[model samples]
Target: MRERNVVSAQTQLLSTVAPSQSPSFDPDLGVITPPSNGMARSAFARPVAPRARWRRRYLACLVLIDFVTALGASRTVVALLDEADAGFWDQRVLGGAVSAFALVTNLVVPLMWMTVLVAAGAYDRRALGRGTEELKRVARANVAMAATVSFLALGFKKDLSRATVAAIILTLLLYTLVTRALARVVLRRIRRVSQRASQKVLLVGRLSDAMAVHEVVTRNPGAGLRPIAIHLPHHPRPGERVTAPVPVYVGWDLVPLVQQLGADTIAVCGPASLESYELRKLAWQLEGTGLDLVVVPQVTDVTGPRIHVRPIEGLPLLNVEEPTISGLSLLVKSMLDRVTALVGLVLLSPLLVGIAVAIKLTDPGPVMFRQTRIGHEGRAFKVWKFRTMYTDAEQRLEALRHRNESDGLLFKIKDDPRVTPIGRHLRGLSLDELPQLINVLKGEMSLVGPRPLPTEDDDYRGDVRRRLLVRPGITGLWQISGRSDLTWEDAVRLDLHYVDNWSLVYDLGILWRTASVVLARRGAY
Candidate 1:
């Protein structure tokens, strides 16, 4: 009897809350929408909303940039070749002046380049302004353009200058990449300042799942998803309070709620209450709404390169590839690390000498500090760095243990009296760690990887041991993210993430960002 009363109350609530021509609802199938009142129009029939205008404008800007880059590159290369060889375009071919052929070729090249890029999905809105996928697509499109040009030249029996063609392709690739990267920088700046630039997302799932999704969104502000509200399947019991930053709503009929909130996206995070049929019904209701639906998967800490989507019949399956910890990539990384370390040590020799002299003058201690650290596969190696602390700093450590700032096994203090006056400046600018290049050169460390801990702090068990799979590094995700300022848990999480998703591209990105982080002195001593 109570169940029937509850059902009656829910029906009455829906009737009172929804519009007069609201979609039909089923007790089992959830909110089912009929084709009446334009609720079920084709996706193409929907008009573009004001919120989506920015995407179209951005796309147009990219197209213009790419077209200009291609034309400019071809023109510049051709002009340079013409200057070097006066008769470059003088030879007549196919009953027309070669100059005319060259003119036509210049115009046709950019068009062909644009067409190939469009076919390769280089300008996909979802990939723009984030991730390495956009750059990869652009690279693939450039390769395709080169191949097409070569095939056409050979098939037509035309003696095209290979140098000019190669130069044009290479120049276009470099220019387009630079322009796109700059565009992303500008877009990120704008989105950071104006919340209106981001997509208003309505989270729909259990409270825990919604909170997890919120945390992920918070961590990645560049994703541009601003959580407006959370919609749960049922009402909270008395004394139960939601701690999420967004407002909370109850009930399964989320279309009207989403519309009312003016949310442009709905993020369904492992909806426990919605069955397959109900989920489909919800999608049906949003067919002509011009809204984006993002279903967040349960997977965590995995990147796009490792995940593959395979569909069988009508079911979509996600296949995650194993992490690459060995093979040719590691060999390349090792060679690069040693080569870079050698060059850095040679170039910075003068600065290193000056620092050594200053350290000798400031305090009475050794110029270099070497401490045993846990390395790959539980091996121990003496890591090298410029001495920044007093000679008796270790002896005085126990007295300061009670005042340690870190919550985990690592110990850190924002302003330690043990540091010498000159040491403070070196630590702040990250110059104190320059000596570690020797370790990198010696194969005891890498240019980029998880930071190795001292021997006493080594707890190589469970997932923590994964950090030992590769050589320790002087700088890593932890360094670029937040050095000593990060909590132990956050630091470990970042280290593990780098270990599981390490790539040459990823290493380069971290190295690039490290310079900015060091300049800003973020989370430094």
Candidate 2:
């Protein structure tokens, strides 16, 4: 009877506590989770997932492992530099002709070591995920760090032979890249196993808001959150916990129920007095006792770069800024678009001609295909491509609409019948998009931007239309990120991320990566 009375009272208190702040605004909007139901109505659109949160212990462990591994790798490189008699190791060795230590206690080596780690972002919690990009980042950071060390060594001391440094650099680069890749694979595997043993969390919040958080953690299961309870703050009392018999006492005896349940995490859905200082104090009281407190909002697909946290009058104020492509930098972007596109068109003219001939022979179509697509400012422009389909491809589109495998407003079929034999080959090699260079030169497109959607007026939400802020790209963050394999939201997020953080350095990086991705053919079809 006492337990029942307590439960009834707790439910009544929860029913009355008002949730604070806006219910729908996303703090960051680029990294949200996609809808699991899978149909997308827009070419480029933000996700429904919250930005990922990670376990501090796991992150700290990964960082420590990476740091030690890097130090050891650095030491091995240094030892090799010492052992190589051909002035390779001897020069870079502490007392040798190539040493950076002539100035201090291997200060340069240590600085190089730290810089390499930092540049690789091995310390970042987000990079713990097993992905090609994470490994690439680590490899790039190590290479850049070693290169900095070698170049600085050479510049400071003329007696230093570049050959020794070069050899050591190449050897270390290969070793480090391979080593990091293997380590990530293993760590991720181990993390997966550990995730299976993760403590289950029961969350209660607004239906839509809670659903977003649920999907986010569920999608990235390795993050170690297994949500088992879902109480709707709007509903006051939840039916029951999903995986365990945990009682969630909201408002009244909330602290006591949390204590009794021995929950590892309590992710309150909305900001109520229950989620305020008292909740934080509850978190503090439970800290050493092993319970984690989490508060997730409806922030969808937002990245940290887009969300700025400011301190105003003792409150944690959030500033969500609008991103745009402007200033003199657009000039640089334009210049790069023109130069790369012109060079691409010039070098590929022979191949283009060959493809054109093949398409003509096979499909009996015009040498070029032009389609109207939405561009920067939502303006319509004709996008050009080497004709890789029958001239009547548009007329046959209706039959393939249902066959569209792409999960968005975009239409694509893995074995599209409209693709002539030659066209399929060209698309596989990304050669069909070659004529887009002319569009770049004509100011209707760029070498990189969000993939443009056709201008036939497919309906889109206001959030989905933001990709039009920049000219459509022949190849872009989306193209290199996954191309056809990317979900609609991923494509949109990558596009928006690029637009928000446009930089000349990033463009050059993308171009360089684009070459590798083309050769690798990660998402051609």
Q: Identify the candidate with maximal lDDT.
A: 1
Q: Any residue pairs clashing in model 1, and if so which?
A: none
Clash counts per candidate, in order, are 0, 16
Per-residue lDDT of 1-525 in model 1, one digit per residue for the tens? Answer: 544443454455345444655544344422223224534424344433236667788889989988888888888877887789887655445457776767655678778889999988898866787757888889999999899989999999988878877998898899888888888877777787775457888898888899888987877676678887777766565656444455555653566566656678888887485677767776776777777888887877888589898999977788889999999999999999999999999999999999999999989979999999998778888989899999999999999998899876687889998999899899999999999999999999999999989855356777888888888998999999889989888888899999889999999999998999999999988
How far is 51's C-alpha from truth in model 1 (Å)? 3.6
- After superposition, the stretches of candidate 2 with alpha carbons farther than 4 Å from their true spots are 1-204, 220-228, 231-266, 272-274, 289-293, 347-350, 398-409, 413-415, 456-461, 476-525
Q: How far is candidate 1 from the true structure (C-alpha RMSD, Å)?
A: 6.6
Candidate 1 structure lDDT: 0.80
Kindly list the per-residue Cα lDDT of model 2 for residues 444-508, writing each as its tens digit: 99887778888554454576777887778877888886788888877777887777766676676
Worst 10 residues of 1 by lDDT: 26-35
Candidate 2 local distance difference test against the native: 0.62
